[model samples]
Target: MGLVIIFLLVALLAIFGLVRSIKDKNLLGAFFAFGSLAVFGWFAIMTIIYNGFPVAH
Candidate 1:
């Protein structure tokens, strides 16, 4: 539950950064925003696979 909430918050922040970058026409800011989002997405996927779909005998 807590993880989900944190993830949502991070996602929102990333979106906000992306919007601001776009409005400011700053490529570096946009890159950072997207890179952070991709990293977060990868972390979420890895966590889900490790916990939600564990392999056991």
Candidate 2:
């Protein structure tokens, strides 16, 4: 439960970072933001696929 909530919040932040970088037109910032987003996104996808949401004890 907590992990899911935290993961969602982090995901939101990553998206926000990406958007802000784009708005500022900073290529380096955008690249790093996207890289960070990709890392988290991969973990999210893996968790969803293997453990599933709401995670079992």
Model 2 Cα lDDT, one tens digit per residue, 1-57? 566557667777888999999999998988988887787777777777786678457
Model 2 TM-score, all chains together: 0.75
**Model 2, stretches more than 4 Å misplaced?**
55-57
Off by over 4 Å in 1: 45-57
Residue 42: error of model 2 in Å? 1.0
Residue 18 CA displacement from its true place in model 2, Å: 0.6
Among these predictions, the greatest lDDT belongs to 2
Model 1, span 36-57: residue lDDT tens: 8777767766676666743446
Q: Considering only N, C-alpha and C atoms within 3 Å, which residue pairs clash in candidate 1?
A: none
